[model samples]
Target: MWHLITAPILLPMFTALLIMLPPIHYSPNRRRWVSMVSSAIQLVLVVLLLLQVQQQGQLHYAIGNWQAPFGIILVADTLSVVLVCLTSFLALGAICYGSAGEDEKGSFFHPLFQFQVMGINGAFLTGDLFNLFVFFEVLLIASYALLIHAGGKNKTKAAVHYVVLNLTGSAIFLIALAVLYGTTGTLNIADMAQKVAQLPASDLMLVKSGALMLMIVFALKAAVLPLQFWLPATYASASAPVAALFAVMTKIGVYALLRVYTTIFGSEAGALSGIAADWLLPAGLATIALGAIGVMASQDFRKLVANLVLLSVGTLVSLVALQTQQAAAAALYYTVHSTLVTAALFLIADLIANQRGKAADRLVSGRKVVQPVLLGMMFMVGALSVAGLPPLSGFVGKVMLLQSVTDPDNRLWLWSLVLLSSLVVIVGLSRAGSTLFWRISGSDTVAETAKPLQVFAVCWLLLASPLLVIFAGPLTELSLQAAAQLYDTNTAVQLILGQEVTP
Candidate 1:
């Protein structure tokens, strides 16, 4: 069963290949079934893997039996598995929603979706920096295609910006890898962590530069500060399911920052300890302020939600920058909450757009939707949740984040920024909700009712908000355990280096 560690990465890959073959590729129904079944199976595998990690600590797999610091290695710790599981769950909702004719809009949608999933799971599981880079490219390539899957002028424009920016990030990622490899003499993360601790004074500056360069790439991915301009247009214009899947894409960068910094440049590494620490807090605050403003200014509902993604990124980065185990746990909880809510909102936006005729998600007065109460209720739930209102998972997450900050300065900055931003978000969303639902034009035509499958997918993801609140106990415990595992860099290095970890 240890080999199941490879299943998350391998399942989607083989599924994609299978999907690209003659019958499945040509037949939309067949392709949809194949993709849906594959995603469901992947989710099951991920749950089993998560359970195994909870019971077994961390699981390690070496490609071709080559150990760490030599050949490819994959490690499934609590943190990595939790992320992989999230990706799988989100992917399932996306594909299920897409099955209602969204997948038929382009060639190879199912295959690309599978490959995207493959890349995300691989990124989460890989134990080497270069492999992580490879996985990044894989996901980006798949996303480039999916972004323009429905083939619109807006999508094309957004795709161009998305592609160019990510290609630049990829170049930076490569350069960082080269510098780190040259400095540490290995790409294996655990090995590099050990090497970073022993580096000479001369190479210290070079390693530091590489590490900082790495943070830039991750910050861009996380949509932080000046690097965040790409996300709003890109996410707002993509097809709904594609946009939903892209929600987790940003978290990859956050995951990288947390993993790489906490391990390689951790406190044990002299002079380079907490290299990105000073930069994270200020950048996070700026990002929050910017995102809140964007949410208020957005004319399009989808764009507003896109900006909410940015706000969540800012909240997460700020929490992670605290570098406490409690903060990490809170960030993880928020990660799950924010990703699910944002994705659900995107789907809801698409549903509303379909119902609003030509006004179509523009946050303008338009014809009443075919199903006002259902869509309105969903929008309200998503908006309240996104704004971090109480009695929901979003509220729980933000409260956890707020409670985790013990330092007076941090508390002042975090509480003020998060609260003010949440207020801005609420005001923005309230305007949007009222405009879309209440200020309707007296038009005779109504859009086709939402498909059952699409509604089901939206409901499935939206359920996460309440369910997260109800199950906050287990989930928060899991997050805390994951956080603890992440901060135990010494044990991680030892385990990856093939040494026994003593209790």
Candidate 2:
């Protein structure tokens, strides 16, 4: 049963290798079956792992039978396992959508897709900071290839920008890791948490610098404020499924911040306590402002959805910045809602674009979709969710976030910004919906109907919105438990380090 901790990472990796082998490599049908089956199994394993975490506290697996701070380790707690499950579930929808026909647009699409899942899963599961970096590279490399799949000039340009920015971030990440390793003498996060507590006064500045640098890297990944310029064009240019999966990619940054800060630099860390919250809250607010502007200004549907992703990032970061159990619970719930909602919008945008003929996804009056009734309904649900309207998970998440903040200053800032930004999103999406569906012009001819599998994929992801609302009680309870686990650094240290290490 302990071996299940590594299955999420290993399954996709082996599936990717299998997809690249002779029989499956040549048969597209075979590749699709393999990818889809692998993703399903991965999802099931992670769910079971989540159940285990609920039954048994935090679980750890020492690779090669070596313990933490000595060899590789994988740890599964509530937070990490939930995220791993989300990754696999999302990947299943994406791969199912691609199998409809998008996989044929490029070589090794199945393999690259499997590898990307592997990297994402590994990133969520690994206990070592260095292994996290390795997983980041793996995912980034696969994304580089996936971004340019069925290459076009605009995609090429976007890929170039994405590659350059992440490469720079990777460099900074490496430098930060070096400094932390030098100062703390360990890269295992649990062990680092132990070491960071007992650091000498003289080395405090260096450790602080390293920690902030790592935050900067994560901020870049999260697309927070000033560093977010690259995301709009890049996401808008990728294929639908790729963009959908990339939704979870951004959340990885938020996850890292929540995990690292709460575990290692919580109130127990003396002068360095809550080091990220001050910078993050303001940055998150600014990001919301920026995203609102982008959503209104966007002329392309995909680009509009991309900006919405930015808006969700802002919301999640701000909730995390609050650093309370309630806030953390809200952040977790919102993370799930936002990721699925945005991914659905991307897939929905692609559906509209495919059906709009020459106008594509541009925000202009054109022919209505052949199945306007179906697509319009889906778009409405997605738009309402994105706007944080009632009867959907988005509304629930926003309410949770609003109720979580107690500080007058934080409430003023968060309430004002979140509400105002949501208003802007509603207006932007309203304009988009009218233009795409209601304001029909030109020829009555619509493009070919969307593939059934594609529609199914969109429906699958979007279904989470209503389901989340229905199961809010149990889900939010799990989130609260996850949050409590994160802040209880002492229990975490003992579980992972296998010895009493004072927090």
Candidate 3:
């Protein structure tokens, strides 16, 4: 049980170190094998942790057996565990996709990939705010290296933009943390939540300001609307598998907002109670509108998928702002749905580009791709899944979100945006697909081809959304259970404080 809690973080950390050792310094192939084995082992560990949370119902492991509030702690709640599992699944497919020469694009691609996973896993498990910042920086540094891995002019510019924006966000994150710590004298989340109510009146304003600033940092990470200007180029500029792995990176921000806001603030946040409610919904709606427009304007497959990521973030944040358990559950299910399909879409775009030869994923009528029937088929499913078309988990996730927000105030507003944006996505995807597949007239020209393992990786990811549909009932229940754990403020606070934990 303890091993389940620590393995995801520890395995990847050691794997990265092992890859760096002089013995393996010369062999990229060996490095890749090491990373793949580590990813597989992490996936198994994540699943085991998820199962443990299911049986034990929200577990916590204080590092070195030190009690919380004094030492670092790792939590295994339903929400954290579910995200760990999602991260591992994406890592596996993305690593496999990269294995087919994507890792060879840079000097330390395999090692950087391991550190990225380690940071993501650490973010999901850490029970304190300071560690969150540390992990965020770890992943950001790794990703910056990754963004410009193949040394593109465009990727370099995008990395500059990404680095500048995230560096600003990180500085702000520290200020917010300082404020929270100054007010409450503890950086531990559970302790802060418990101590918030007891803060002197003089410190209340600073706490509220800190909380608001924290959300701003998270929004920057999630890339919603105005803050989203940094995302499109950054994602579109990366090599395929790095971009695919990144599909889950923005989601880490979403996960933070979901976990922290609900857990730390909740209904009892006092002046902070409705901190995000007022503007978040409206901002989220604007993000959806803007992303839909971006999708329509996009001239290439990479850009289209990039905007789809923003669109997905908009939809999730809008529903999340509703502040209901139902919304959390829907958001969780949708998170899984979106991450898998987004990865598939990125890899599919790269694969399609390979097949299209001179056409090369441009949204124009050009030469046909050689032997791309399966690739085209995968793209269609992926696009539908992104557009929230029926029977797939994407549709089910949206329905769950809709069902959650049936109140008069949000119902009409959310429904209109969801349905309307989805239609716009459908049209944009249809236009892109039609121009690429149907409008083209000539035979393949360049004849570039995708590796079998790369195709298998893409297919493996594409299958997750449909499989979610097959297991929708059980999965939704698990999501609801996770959301319940998230909302159960007392249970978490008590568990982390080393008080007798609730079942």
All candidates' lDDT scores? 0.91, 0.91, 0.87
Q: TM-score for every candidate vs. truth?
A: 0.98, 0.99, 0.97
> Considering only N, C-alpha and C atoms within 3 Å, which residue pairs clash in candidate 2?
none
Tell me the lDDT of candidate 3.
0.87
Quote model 2's TM-score.
Answer: 0.99
Comparing 2 with 3 on lDDT, the higher-scoring candidate is 2
Worst 10 contiguous positions by lDDT, candidate 1: 494-503
lDDT of 1 by residue, 174-209 (tens): 999999988889999888888898888999999999
Candidate 2 ranges beyond 4 A from true positions? none
Please report how far candidate 1 places residue 303 from its true position, in Å: 0.1
RMSD of each: 1.5, 0.9, 1.9
Worst 10 residues of 2 by lDDT: 494-503
